[model samples]
Target chain A: MKLDRRAFLGTATAATATLAAPAVMGSARPHVVVIGGGSGGATAARYIASGAEGAIDVTLIEPSRMYYTCYFSNLYMGGFWDFDNLGHDYGNVALLGVNIIHDWAIGVDRDAKTVTLASGPSLSYDKLVVAPGIDFVDDAVPGWDVSKQSLMPHAYKSGTQAQLLKHQIENMREGGTYCMVAPPNPYRCPPGPYERISMVAHVLSERNPTAKILIVDPKENFSKQGLFEEGWARHYPGMVERIGPDFGGDRVEVRPDDMEVIIDGQTQNVDVCNVIPAQKAGKIAELAGLTNDAGWAPVMPADMRSRMDEDVFVLGDASHQGAMPKSGFSANSQATVVANVIRGELTGSRIFPARYSNTCWSLIATNDGVKVGAAYEPGEDQIESVSSFISQTGEDAELRRQTYEESIGWYNGIVDDIFG
Target chain B: MPKLTFSSILLAGALLAPAGVFAQATPIGDAEAGAQVYQRECASCHQIGEGALHRIGPHLNRIFDRRAGSYEEFRYSEALSRQGRDGLRWDLARLHAYIENPRALVSGTRMAYRGLRDEKRRADLIAYIRAYSDQPQNIPEASPTALRAEVELSEETLAIEGDAEFGAFLSAECTTCHQRSGDHAGIPGIVGWPQEDFVVAMHAYKQELRPHAVMQSVAQRLDEEEIAALAAYFENLGN
Candidate 1:
């Protein structure tokens, strides 16, 4: 769990091995080429290689050398975590005998069972795990595109954009208005927007108490709505206001040059505008013809295997599985299941029935955390929730503190579970 | 019909020689059933096996006859620490009662679990805990007073209708660890399992016949129909 010098050495060795040979040398070993070394893909690659005990070859294809988790980036905004804490290298994952390729997976040739990378030889695979995470729908918010990202950062992808958003929030003039255009339902991290708002409020509450936060949300209700509202009331009274769909929250447009957000056709100049646009599966999944009209991949509940292709498994935010939210925890949990299933299929290891679980923890303020968790089993059509538990609205401060501590522990545990 | 081994008797004698706490009878409960209970309820907080680390709760290796709050590495609640200071050893009766309701025995205890209400299930869980003792063969017999019939469901009992769709939705909590597909590592997979088996297992956890705290808590929340629904859903999943 500790990232010490020895761990760094281990990663260096693995990276050296990967660069030396783009494709694994053993032709007899089943190759698992994973796209997107985020939570799902990295966990899958690690688990498959470790579970197989070198019986199979795993080549993880991710363009980035470092992964910034979207999970706790909100905490980073709130100054609870540093930028370095959100970033992780694949050294630990590579240590598990996985070929960590830092290149884009441009295309997947299903007929040939090969993955064409942006700058490397096409890698062949017996099984492929696509966990490309979410890509914003172009023009999801009218007049918004990648070019205007610097002007109005989405900060949804959790790396440079997040830093940019943080920088903008920090530099906002005193008493300035911070406006957020929330994404619609079925976006990554159902509660993420709200949590981010809370974090921003936390920062603003300390720095510029006179500042205002306005949320123009598309949905009538959001995840943990009551808890968040209660926390906002208690912590930052009169400072935060939300406009739901009834008040034209969905009908909003932005002019990046003017730094103005128009809600219900009323243009308001704001110091900072966070526009989280509509989202879909990453482009690679679509390019591979794995996605449906919904812009997400349909996966079987049994093992997260793609409905379109049996050998290809889709996971995380990109997968259109029933009930489970498109959160990091859900993706990691799914990755473990997929890894085990794929390992069982390839290595002839002991395969058991699939079970899944996820818990989402949000910090309403410092030392104030709430969580919702559930256990699930595969159903006839989709993965289902058997039972669930969530933090109550009127929980005491001591319990909230404990919940926050638990979240910290969980963050450490999950990162270890995935990267290690 | 049961043969008492010499080592078991010797263990029983050694255990009884000092405390004379346990009733001189054979521990009669299903270890397998106890394992299920332990996994669902106790595994998260307590560890009983080799190299078990002290988690939220203390490691419980050879806990039988050990003084309360005596695990060297664990920081006990004041109530439990005081009980240990008073030389209160954990006998079968006390351990059973404590697990059924930790706060009842030692008020203000930090253990979050509510008491296990089912007496028969408590005995089975104790038997399972007893099996992990260093000299498990030496543990005394379970008290007859706590004994009850093993829960069994007939075809008619399992005939409770369930909707797979609803069951799938309800199973999200279970799948948090069980996984819908793949190697469970330590956790077992529940997919493609028979409906009857799933129902029985869930019922066992629900009824406190199993020792796992989490599973017991999950099962206790479900009705027979809900359990049946989950069973139906998992039964038809995977190959």
Candidate 2:
């Protein structure tokens, strides 16, 4: 039950015929090129290379040498986690015989099975994995874009945005308002926006109790709504106010230049505005012609193969995953399945059944943590949840503390698993 | 139900004599009729007689007065595990509720059966299961053995040798949170345990005996050989 080198060499030669990539053709093993070195792509590359054991050549293309995870960015915002702990390098990933290319993957030629990098190199691949997390939809919010991120600061993506948002929160006026225009449904980390709100409330309650927190949310409900509400009432009473869609939250506009939020044509001055607009798959997936009408790449239920292209797979937040939230845990779980399937196809390894699970732990205030998780299996058309659980609202302090501690452990374990 | 045995009278006497000072006396339901209920509902997943091996579920020997999900050899659901860790014991009252509706007792339990709804049948089933368990009141004398059928397993149960190569492939799921360098800062290190211990622990998780949602989900998906393979791979890592 093994695929020999000749079969891989035959496909490799055919896939690279149009390109002048000698390294790929000369190599005896198959090549797997993964784009975006976040949780999905990094774990995929590491697993394939390690599982193949020299039988396959894996290359990972990511723009940043050090990846700062979005999972714990909220913790950093709340001053619970150090910023340095959120970053991980690909040194150990490179040590595992994976070709680490710190370059942006500009384009993918599905016809030629080649990935064109921004630094002027086109690498051919037998299989391509696209894990470019997400990009904000164009003009989803009026007067909001990545360029004005310095002013409004989406802080949605990893790295500098978080730092910028934190700086703004710290230096805000004593009684100034901190407004967050939360995104709609199908966004990465369903509990993320609420968690961010909790973090912001935490910082404000401690520093400026008089300062107000305004949540201009588009949706009527959010992840762990009950638990977050309970914690807010108990810990930061009279500090947080959420305006759902009923009060014109959906029809909102932000003027970054004037530093004002217009909710249903009524303008309100705010000190800091965190605009998390509607999101879509990263631009590269759309460029690769893998995205659908919904701004996400539809993937096969079994292995996350892009429905548009067989050779290409879309993982993580970019993927329109059913019954699985777009989170780092979900992405990492999917990446392992992708790696196993890719290895089985290219190197003739044993392919196990795809099993996916995700657990999101959000810290409400200090040691008050809540979690929701589910086990998923591939159904006929989409991934279906088999079992699930969510933390109760009235949980005791000890369990909450343990949940928070477990999250830290999980963070360490996932980063180690991804990078190494 | 069969006529009350001589020990039942003595047990009833013991419970009634202390009622003025302690809790009320409840009949230890009919064991003979309960044996039928066990055959119909519980036998498919659980085993209770002598030499009962860990099958789909853990052997139910010595279940009374035992901590919930505490059998090291069996895998219990994370829900059950947490309840056990939260000081839940398999007392008569708790057992009745669990048998009546498992999910009501533990939300994420993996026990697939819809539960025995009949109160009398449930009580009978509990009585049947209780026969194999330790009785604190009967500590001086050996507890009576059940008249149920025995389970004889081959000497070479789980005898399949783990292939380290396959284990290496499987270790991808584990190493995500557990460092390969075995630096257990927040998560416990999984490297370098005895293969047998590893196998047993994984089985406990697979059986859902161990707590932790992610671990239970991950372990439940793995087959017996894969567990062995992972055990062998993790045991030999960095050596």
Candidate 3:
């Protein structure tokens, strides 16, 4: 019989009492209720359930029957990975004995340690993990809000809107204008709008080379600015342009049907408008009263638990605990932290803390991809990047091939981390 | 699985008690189950020689007792590197803690790997990472040449001076699409180009014309003066 001393200690202690020493188990495993089966929530559910099998009851509550990734949908707009590659079934999670409930978490009674769902069902948990993804802040942009999403089509959240943007692009004849307005600081996928422009340009170059892609940006420059611009030019020449706030692109206005995007003092009519409206946490956060004045939840970094409530943990695109953009990679990374902390807290064990990593891949064109990646460690209160890298300026055959290849690998890896 | 006689196991530890045995006995993790975890979560990010492939993160060759976040090429988050440089190594106990919540341990890190809070999963992931313990450090793997193009272009910038003709040639095609003065999607107006900034930009483009299919051909035709003229042209447009 071989017995490791480390295992010996764990079993000896665990034998006497469940990890939750104070909270007695109901004859089964300790209940771990997870909200939002997106990147963070899904990853947490998979890891926790798989790791502790019978030791924990992992329940995941998600609104959507099928989850759609905001990542790579740009490529979908450009016709890259099919919906299958990006779409994930939660069966893998179900195989791990995790109760995957397709429902939305509407209310959280922190005092009672209860979660009320939209369907009038309630679940209690010894520990809770929340990874509800981003919420678009409609009020941030005047004259532009959720009601206007139908017209403007931010396409930031992905799904049907992503298809709608494609429809808009295909509908526009050559020589027509296509405009995209970017949000200010602290937005999801900072390099996203640029990638969308590049992809749209790629599509335009194929369908209508004479067509144009105009970017009305809030910032002077965007993430991986050099690489994106280079890719845009090499792949789709004369199809794209960028304007900034200082140059009259600030607080831009758009009329969807008429096809107009205005910045500063000037207004212009065009064929299509894709404005990525300001973003916050998803509606669930606001509904639960977890959002602050800025429309994002602030949390204690130790466990990514919201300041608004202790029993509840808010993560992914919703929380403002770390200094990182709201991307699939970052959200997936954040899920790891939240899952670990909840596991430790439930078991009364000391939690191991580590750094976070965010590597976002943006496709400038079909095979031309640029990546903005960074390695970050949690700061005193924020997550700060230590080293960052982006795609090179020129499109050498070797780099182009590698970037393209890596983009696929990145996609597959992220998908597995969540639904796989 | 053979049933282990309890007293004999205890006696074995007592009899073979080696000095400096500080190994903490933790819960049992089925290595077989851990192996699945290894393949799913770990093998993606870590490279354990043949079985492990290189992920965006690091190769976990001989990762145990390895300093925390001390990979040279991987360029760790300042926070992790600082701690590793501070003399922390990945012992089992520490490994468990880090796998759970990396941020709670080290701030300013970018591992993005959510800690495997499930002790069993942590054990499995650890087992997977530890499988490379005997292997040597896989150091300084050169980046594929294509990945370095951005680095090369980064060295050459668009150097501008006060010249409208060069700016006009530089931005000639620009005005055809971009409003030389308005803001909107996909169009960056070339109004008020800073002289020095314009000069640098043209030189960059003239070198390759701007790292794209269109810009490369466009900048190739322009002489250095044409680039400057374009810089000056845009500089004077708004001013």
Top-scoring candidate (DockQ): 2
Candidates in descending DockQ order: 2, 1, 3
DockQ score for model 1: 0.05
Clashing pairs in 2: A413-B176, A413-B177, B75-B204, B75-B207, B75-B208, B75-B209, B76-B207, B76-B208, B76-B209, B77-B208
- Model 2, A67-141: lDDT tens digits are 999999999999999999889999999878788877788999898777887867677778999999999998888
Off by over 4 Å in 2: A1-25, B1-157, B163-166, B206-208
Model 3, TM vs. native: 0.60
Per-residue lDDT of B76-180 in model 2, one digit per residue for the tens?
897677667544566665576567656545656889978777878876677777667655553212123221111111235357688887787667667766888
Provide all candidates' interface root-mean-square deviations.
9.3, 2.6, 21.1
Candidate 2 matches the true fold with a TM-score of 0.77
Which candidate leads the pack in TM-score?
Answer: 2
Candidate 3: what lDDT? 0.64
- lDDT for B24 (candidate 1): 53
